[model samples]
Target: MTTHSATLREEIEEMIAVGELKPGQHLDETELAARFGVSRTPVRETLIQLASMGLVVIRPRRGAIVAELGPQQLVEMFEVMSELEATCGRLAARRMTREEQQSLLAAHQACLDARDAQEPDVYYYKNELFHEAIYAGSHNQFLIEQTRNLYRRLRPYRRLQLRVRDRLHNSYHEHDGVVQAIVSGDGELAAHLLREHVMIQGQRFSDLMASLPQLRQGAA
Candidate 1:
């Protein structure tokens, strides 16, 4: 995809995520192209990327439509993500080299700095690095790839979690627990803490749905 396609993708994703693109609504390539003052080629390419992310679906004759997951489906993805993260933490606790441990602590410190400065966006980026450190530290190539893929799939929803009132601070404290457990080589506690860290609670789920009104709307 070109630079234009990448920007268009973000725009369309924002529309779908915020309810401007209703669930099941067809994404007319021609209209999008006209709207963006570009050729349909870029819009088409943008939809392809969105389709890959489960944010849209490209049909044989139906064009593209928004992808909406039921609440149950959302919960299921989070559960799987939590388990994967837990496994990564468990392995990293016992398997990480001294250098890896230092890197993980550095990531955690970055998160603390972001939290103290109240920069959710910074915290969000730092949080990704922190998780990636643990994922890499797991030393399981297959597991790293799998977790990274799912992590990207869940990116939008997880990023919004940072905007939840006081969520960044809360997440920092949670990270503290996981870091301590990992630093001490307590695989069991590290696993447990990491699982809880990523699992979206019922209240958090509702909060996310409320924030993204499109998520609660009926199919178009």
Candidate 2:
């Protein structure tokens, strides 16, 4: 994506993540252009990019609408995604070069900076880098591609997760554990920690679900 389109896409994704643009809501390109003070071209390009990420659906005659996934579907996807991440962590623990390990540590430190700053949005982007570092550390091109595809599709939800009260701090702590396990070359422990880190369940699941209703209400 072009820089303009990328920026527009992130902005739109943020709106969707916070429920400012609820699922199934139409995304009119012209209106979006006006809203962002840009031309229709970039807005159109962003919609196409968003469509590729499964964040929006484009219709034949109609325009684009935010894509919707049922709760069960979301859960199933997360379950599979967690396993993919766990596999990456397992392989990375055994495979990461010294340089790659340092890179991962740098990414983790960047996340810590953002978290300490108490800037969730900044932390969110840094969090992406931290995860991407692990994905690359796996050194498996096909595995990286597969994991990234799903990660992009679920990006907004992952961002939304941070909004679930103290989740940002909790996530940072989890990342710390994951980094330690991988750096220590503990494949089994890394895999287990990564799986637990990514899995959305128990109180986390309840907190996320509870936040959604409030977001929807605010949007309404």
Candidate number of the best TM-score: 2
Compared with the true structure, what per-residue lDDT tens digits does model 1 show for residues 125-182? Answer: 8999999999999999999999998887777678778877889989999999999998
Clashes per prediction? 0, 0
lDDT of 2 by residue, 8-105 (tens): 99889878876788789999998999988999999999999999988899999999999887677778888988999999999999999999999999
lDDT of each: 0.87, 0.89
By summed lDDT, the worst window of 10 consecutive residues in model 1 runs over: 211-220
Q: Which 10-residue span in candidate 2 carries the lowest summed lDDT?
A: 211-220
The TM-score values for the models, in the order shown, are 0.86, 0.93
Misplaced by over 4 Å in model 1 are 34-39, 213-220
Shift in Å, residue 84, candidate 2: 0.9
Pull out the clashing pairs in model 1: none
Candidate 2 structure, TM-score to reference: 0.93
